[model samples]
Target: MNNDESQPENNKPKYKGKYRIDSTRLPAWSYASNAGYFITICTHGKKCFFGEVVQGEMQRSPIGVIAQKLWYEIPNNFSNCQLDSFCVMPNHIHGILVINQIREGDAMNIRIQEEDAMNRVSTSQRGDGQRGGVTGLFNPMLSKNSLSKIVRWYKGRCSFEINQIYEGFGWQQRFHDNIIRDEFALDQIRQYIINNPINWESDREHPPHPPL
Candidate 1:
């Protein structure tokens, strides 16, 4: 019997070096694929800038209202995206964002933002003012319907609006996402979103100010 071959594969040493932060995303995964994604975005340093929890319920401050306003606007900005369950917490948020199928000729117009803010245009009105063929764009990075791109737009818009009133409002540099693999898992995540406010005190994403 060969001792080397007999050793379990788990005992092998692939690398004897310090590990660095690895991506949370699955390797070779195409986010553009039609699916449901559970996402969480935290405020900078998990600060309770949005609002507070009173009686086990989340109450969005004036600023928190802005955070939620932009969240619900995601579908308006990206034609093929739809929001499932979502809730705005004091310092963090939880939601299930679904990328849905787009039928043909449904697109009436498309809009994109460039490096120059002054050059930005908001309206993408088609003759019928409808959105169509979102997946046909092919290049997810550049497509209006891409998940990452949609998130970026939402963050940027919310920051822009909030900053106008409260300067330096920001979100964490990186957000977290979990890919939903089955209908059962999808329903579970959606329920979590709905119950986030009720579970605020016990939530890991909850802030430290209230000292829960």
Candidate 2:
């Protein structure tokens, strides 16, 4: 029998589940304009291989190395974007990404600051404003680029290269994102990312089964 045929095919996911949306075709309404977004990405079904705390320090694992490489490469890949804060845990990652640009009608009098840029738009406005501007808030006019597409590209590229390095590891079909509305929320999320490693043991997504 072929080596491929000898192994069980059940390990592969049968359905994309919630993660298979074609990010490039994400409705225009989902675009994240000149704003700050807090993003979390997990390994394929939250496989935890990045690291386990040993002696109170995060020792590098294959997944951890891949996450770190991707974290540093964010700025290089996305122009007008800066990585404010981030953390790579064994099974997942949390990051603060600020997309810098002046929105129409935004104050051009003042030089664009990262914080000011992020706060320029409101998350409530980014929703699908239907009930009194609830869903319509995420109107297509506000977004400059397709947030979903960018994330898809980033994750896809990362997965391809990481798999090359490690041979078979993979990423989940999609990632999770939340727009930061105010300075307070931004700060809170930043703190969460910074402290993620400290709270790893209790993470809900920590994979229970390991590859045999």
User: Quick one: best lDDT, which candidate?
Assistant: 1
Off by over 4 Å in 1: 1-24, 105-143, 210-212
Candidates' TM-scores? 0.69, 0.63
lDDT per residue (tens digit) for residues 1-212 in model 1: 11100111222211112111122454223455577877777788888878887886877888899989999999887878888888888887777888875755333223212222112222222223322222122223544466677777877898899999888778887666667789987776666666666777666666557621
User: How many clashes in each structure?
Assistant: 4, 9
Residues 107-131 of candidate 2 have per-residue lDDT tens digits of: 3422242244334335435554432
The candidate scoring highest on TM-score is 1
What RMSD, rounded to one decimal, does every model reach?
14.7, 11.9
